[model samples]
Structures are given as structure tokens and as C-alpha cells.
Target: MQIKLIAIGKTDNSNLITLIEDYTKRLSFYIKFDFEIIPDIKNVKHLSEAQQKDKEGELILAKTQTSDILILLDENGKQMDSVAFSSYLQKHMNSGIKTLIFVIGGPYGFSNALYNRANGKLGLSKMTFSHQMVRLFFIEQLYRGFTILRNEPYHHR
Candidate 1:
């Protein structure tokens, strides 16, 4: 199955972009991986937090297809270890889905509609992380998961 990560806003830090690209390239060797960035919502200063989330949610929803399984990267999501996450990836692949999409929402997080639409929610950590950093961490974890699935030395037992 093809895996896609969709996040809002551009990552301006050159160092973070380079690292994210490195992992993305590494991940391509195992599966079709796509990283998409939704431009940040303009005039956010004029909008309420709820309104901002609503607008961002609409953009996020528009990127997805009806057949896609959407998973939100939420702070309150189900947290799992690396091995369990690898198994989760394996399960999705075994299910024969075309694409599994994971979304990293904007500053205020997701909208009510997005929460209702998600098939699942995953938390990378109990601690908060910047959206840009999450991209790198998540991609590297994807690479690690694939390596673990292959019994490679990338992940320590």
C-alpha cells in the first residue's frame, strides 16, 4: 500500500527539510511514500481558532479520496511502541488498501468534522512537537518500521 503524509504549512528551516528529504528517500526503497504540504491558511489573525481549524480541515479533507483511510496525528491519539507500530503497518498492508493517509493538522489542531472522518488516530509522543519536526520523526519511524519488518538491524530489540 502507498502511504502518504499530509501536513499544513511549509517547513522553513533548511536543516529540517534536508533531514525530512533524507528519510523520505530512504523510505521510497521499501514502499511508495508521498509527502504533501498544504499551504498555511492566510489571514489567520482575523479568524478564531475554531474557524481556522475548520478552514484547514476543509483543505485537509479535500486532499483525500473517498477510499482512503484517514488517520490523524493527534496529541490524544493512541500511543504505541515501535514494534507495535510496525505491526500496524503490516496489518494495513495485509488489508489490501490502496492508500493510507496520515494528517498533521494546523496550530489549533483538527476540526470536529475531521475527527468524525478519521479511521484512526495515532500519537507519536505524549510530549508535543512542532509540525516540521513531526514530519522528520514520523518519516524516520516509517523507515525504521520497514527495516524491522525485514529483520534488518535498523531497529534495536
Candidate 2:
């Protein structure tokens, strides 16, 4: 299955982009991977948190197909270790899914509509992380998961 990471806003830090790119490249060897950045909503000062999330949710939903399996990277979601996550990925791959979409929401988090559309949610950590930083962390964990599956040296016990 093709794996797609959809995140809100651009990543301004060049260092983070470079690291994210490195992992993205490595992940390509194992499975088809795509990273999509949705432009940040404008005039956020005029809109409430819920409004911003509503707008972002519209944009996020537009990028997806009805058949795509959507997973949100949420704070209140299931937290899995690297090995378990690797198994999770394997299970999805075995399921004959067309596309697996993992979304990183905006600063205000996801809307109720978006949450309802998701097949599952995954938490990277209990502590909060910036949206940009989460992209790197998720990509790295994806790479690590693939390495573990392949019995590679990238992830050590």
C-alpha cells in the first residue's frame, strides 16, 4: 500500500526539512511514501479555534479519497512502541489497502468531523510537539519501523 503523510503548514526550518527528506528517501526503498503539506489557513486571528480546524478539515478531507484509510496523529490516541508500530504497518500492508493516510493536524488540533472520518489515531508521545517537529519525528519513526521490519541496523534494540 502507498503511505501518505498529510500535515498542515510549511516547515520553515531547513534543518528539519533536510532530516525529514533523509528519512523519506530511506522509506521509499521499502514502500511508496508521499508527504503533502497543506497551506496554513489565513486570517486565523479573525477565526476561532474551532473555525480554523473546520477550514483545515475541509482542506484535509479534499486531499483524500473515500477509499483511503485515514489515521490521525492525535494526542489522545493509542501510543505504540517502535516494534509494535512496525507490526501495525505490516498488518496494514497485508490487508491489501490502496492508501494509508496519516495526518498531522493544525495548531488547534483536528475538528470533530475529521476525527470521525479517521480509521484510527496514533500518539507519538504524551508531551506536546510542534507541528513541524512532528513531521520529522513521524518520518523518522516510519523509517525506523521499516528498518526493524527488514532486520536492518538502523534501529538498535
Model 2, position 75: C-alpha lDDT score: 97
State every prediction's TM-score relative to the real structure.
0.99, 0.98
Q: Return the lDDT, model 2, position 116.
A: 88
lDDT of 2: 0.96
Error of 2 at 137 (Å): 0.5
Instruction: Give the distance in Å from residue 52's predicted Cα in candidate 1 to where it truly belongs.
Output: 0.4
Q: What RMSD value applies to candidate 2?
A: 0.6
Superposed on all Cα atoms, model 1 deviates from the true structure by an RMSD in Å of 0.6
Show model 2 residue runs off by greater than 4 Å: none
Distance (Å) between predicted and true CA of 129, model 2?
A: 0.9
lDDT of candidate 2 over 80-138, digit per residue (tens): 99999999999999999999999999999999999989999999999999999999999
For model 1, the superposed segments whose C-alpha errors exceed 4 Å read none
Residues 36-120 of candidate 1: C-alpha lDDT, one tens digit per residue = 9999999999999999999999999999999999999999999999999999999999999999999999989999999999999
Using lDDT, give the best candidate's number: 2
